[model samples]
Target: MAGVDEPECALPLDSRDVRCCCLLRSFSHFIVKNPTMNCSVQTPQIVGKDAKQHTLSPTCTGASVLGIKFSDGVIIAADMLVSYGSLARYLDVERISMVNDNTVMACSGDIADYQLLKRRVEEQTHTDSLLSDGFTLSPRALHSWITRVLYNRRSRMNPLWNTYIVGGLESDGKPFLGYCDLLGVSFSDDCLATGFGMYLALPLLRQRLEDQAGGDPRKLSKENAVQAITDGMRQLYYRDCRAFKTYQMAVVTSSGVEVRSPLQLETNWEIADYVAGYE
Candidate 1:
């Protein structure tokens, strides 16, 4: 750099090449001489107001969503908190939303992306209504459509950056629960959870399901399903950093869909005193 003039490296200015790397001998000489020196270095631009970039740092993200299928309906739950980095930015945010009369969905991750999906899905359902062919978008149909959308985005390397859980009763009155992530991976089970809930809440749901009629969701009653969801949500509040005490739950039954909000649990922190590092 002391002898050469003008830039020679490419746009990235690779440091791996000998011509680009700074010589240790030159640095040592400069250190010994203690002379003020000037050199030109190519620094790539990293920060800018780019419209195409949305939440590159993953701000305003939700935590987890849990769902289960009962004997007569399907139920899903999510906390009311949307976090901006480590700070709890929005506390009253509702992550569970109605897709149609028979379908309800819960989401975790970028709330902006979730809102975009919400509008797109609404437009899709509205277009379906315009058909007037006596056909409606069922839970499975909506889930399949969402799966394809996510998969297409993933293939383009511009994923939605969210996890979705769809729950509802199909036209035949049979309950359904499905899970899909930004990677387009999708599957349905008796119980479903996303994000931290998958690790902390899913085991409880699965155990509850297994205890009933050998993990058969159809054998589960409304009360049992609600109890399981409540228990899992409570655990998430205690364990998950992004989870909140206040949450919402949606139940899609043959009669109709009912969503309950601002639910809390009575927690006992006395057990913390027994731990080794308690102050």
Candidate 2:
């Protein structure tokens, strides 16, 4: 039994070692990390027989975005829809990441890439040396850092394979929201959308925005902004099967970040008049 514990090639990892493994996983790439050695062994970052070609895995897609603002507040909503190939295999793919206590990140891309981005962000949060005299990562600095990280990877021809929407309170404690895409193209707009949703869902959202002067939801309440999105989702549901009757939504404000699930609308008989004579 004692010999079994000390095998010829290696020793079994104890619970404490296993705990370190868990931490390493949460703070690392997909490969193993040897903490005692104070070194990291990166696994294959990405593996594909055809490295030069682009293949859509059942792992990506169903990426969507909906944002609303009311009373100087911003709310973002997305569905956890991960498709396997063209087939909508997984309807519950979560694209959101929590950065520290005040930020939320929504992602779209290869799931593996998304995971890598999350690990890198976690590692950043742990490093005390990176902070300025002020404690906590500055929102502007952090956003710029994230953008550069994504862009650098793309320049290496190994892009992170993700588009991102970052929402949270800034260092000055103001509500902020921004968007970054796979090519590292980033922009901060009062409203934004990505994926197929950009096509079908955005038009309706724009109309709503026009109702409030291109993203001014002060004319509307948080509840109404959310309702606008809910209504848009219902419209997309009838138009896009990839979108669900149930979706996830989030709101970011000076109050903090709030995310919800199974957010749905009552769609029983209200649209009968719209489809009455068509079909």
Candidate 3:
């Protein structure tokens, strides 16, 4: 009673009460400094009991990523439209990105998820560069890494909701084209397509390769590959309602990755005019 101070109140000092008192004291000081402040402590609102139970779904989505490998390099393309439901929301979205000097990637599905994946790839590439001394991830290595990442996310029940086409030249300068989807299933082919591209463009690509180069991607020239990719894109714009005429394409070779300017495919409405459903 002499040396020790009396309890602030007759009530026992509980930890919760102590915390509330400390907070009130700090708020009181803040109010003293700013007398105009409205110092009212409203009851905390309970918004939700399980915020983490919500499942993520794609809002803005892209469509139909296409890629083909040729003798000199690999070419990949995707449309610029990012759609919200049936409404075309964002135009001029670059769905294709160069991952390195010899590698490029095209993605279809959630544009936001693709952007997150792109940042992860960039961070991994930068880390590899910092640690490799001189060497960096080859096209195949990058593809494998991306596959594992997608698989891991899928296993966690939070997939990226995208299909990715990876294209580049190997360290030996051989053309490489690989595909991976939200479920993490991956494979390599002379040509690859995602989303509606698989249904609408793959046949044309395979036909072009077969007709022009005996179905061997390695036998196709750069011009042939570019033409085939552009043809596929044009067809997608015509057929795939999710697709747009404005698109971006990337050519990856041993020299480097060249992402051309966004190009618009020419369209003809004459067919629409002749259709029975035409207005």
Off by over 4 Å in 2: 1-59, 128-134, 213-219, 268-279
Q: lDDT-based ranking, best first?
A: 1, 3, 2
Q: Report the C-alpha displacement of residue 205, candidate 1, in angstroms.
A: 0.5
Q: Indicate the residue-level lDDT of 127 in model 2.
A: 78
Report the lDDT tens digits of candidate 2 across residue range 123-174.
8777743665456654455667779988987787667777777776676666
Pick by lDDT: which candidate is best? 1
Local accuracy of candidate 3 as per-residue lDDT tens digits, 1-279: 123333568877666766776777787788899998876789886775665652367889998999898889888898889999789999988988888898888899888889998998899889978896877667788789889999999999888888999988888889889999988999999988999899999999999999999988778898988888888988988888899999998888777988986888987778875668544
Clashes of each: 0, 5, 0
For residues 60-120, write the lDDT of model 1, one tens digit per residue.
8999999999889999999999998999889999999898889988899999999999999
Select the stronger candidate by lDDT from 1 and 2: 1
Q: List pairs with backbone clashes in candidate 2.
A: 57-85, 58-83, 58-84, 58-85, 80-93
Ten residues in sequence with the least summed lDDT for candidate 1: 12-21
